[model samples]
Target: MRIVEAIGIGVLILLAALALLFLRRMVITRRGGTIELGVRLSTMVPGRGWSAGLARFAGDDLRWYRIFSFWPGPRRVLSRRGLAVDRRRAPDAAERLVLPPDWVIVRCVTRRSPVEIAMAERALTGFLSWVEAAPPGESTPDTRPYRYRAG
Candidate 1:
């Protein structure tokens, strides 16, 4: 009877944790425009270490939140300043296994570090436009004019 009680308690705790995660995601999506994006901290390996997450654009900054995380805040906040696009490409054979077939891989270099973001072609187009867009009297020196058309 004691063992049964402990198992029941554990199940309840797990259910509550899942509910918390669901609520957190709802709040994040409601806060701003969210897009499905996968981020890799280091781009050293072409097809590894990618974490699936949702990203929100907030005042020239992109905030990333992991899909199944407990943290209420963004795990990474990538600012537009000092951001440069290294290159973009289609997923390799190995990457195809992990990433969606329609997604494009964009490698970017920020002031702090390098990151790889995998997203759909249309989404990438929008993201690039956001990066290239500049405010009045403000120029993006590190960022050069680059275009990616969905094909």
Candidate 2:
């Protein structure tokens, strides 16, 4: 009877902790000026495919947070200056499971390291605009003129 009561108390404590974590995530996501969009992230490593998550545009950088993580911080940050879009494509069969439906993947090189991001077509347009819109008096790393390409 004593042991059963202790076990029940422990379970309740764990449940309370999980509820607090969920509320914390909700508050941070809602108050951090976050953009709620599905994003798939991939590194340059061979055979390591994409992982989907939520991307938040914070200042001049984009922060990506894992979908299943309980933490309230981003796992990756891509700066505007170092980001360069290399190509765009539709996700393969395996990638479809991770990414949102009809979303396009944009392959990019940032600080000479390759990264892939997936987002909706409309969001991609906004992302391109954000990247291209450098502050006045500052030149973009890619000094060449900007041209939109239809994929």
In terms of TM-score, the best-performing candidate is 1
- Against the hidden reference, what TM-scores do the models get? 0.88, 0.73
Q: Which has the greatest lDDT?
A: 1
Residues 16-130 of candidate 2: C-alpha lDDT, one tens digit per residue: 8889777756765785645545543434544245665667777778988776677777888888777777778877776776666868877767776777777887788788877
lDDT of 1 by residue, 6-80 (tens): 999999999999999999889989976789999986557757888899999997889999998999999999887
Clashing pairs in 1: none
Please give the clash total of every predicted structure, in order. Answer: 0, 0
Range of the 10 consecutive residues with the lowest summed lDDT in candidate 1: 142-151
Q: How accurate is candidate 2 locally (lDDT)?
A: 0.70
Q: How many backbone clashes does candidate 1 have?
A: 0
Return the TM-score for candidate 1, rounded to 2 decimals. Answer: 0.88
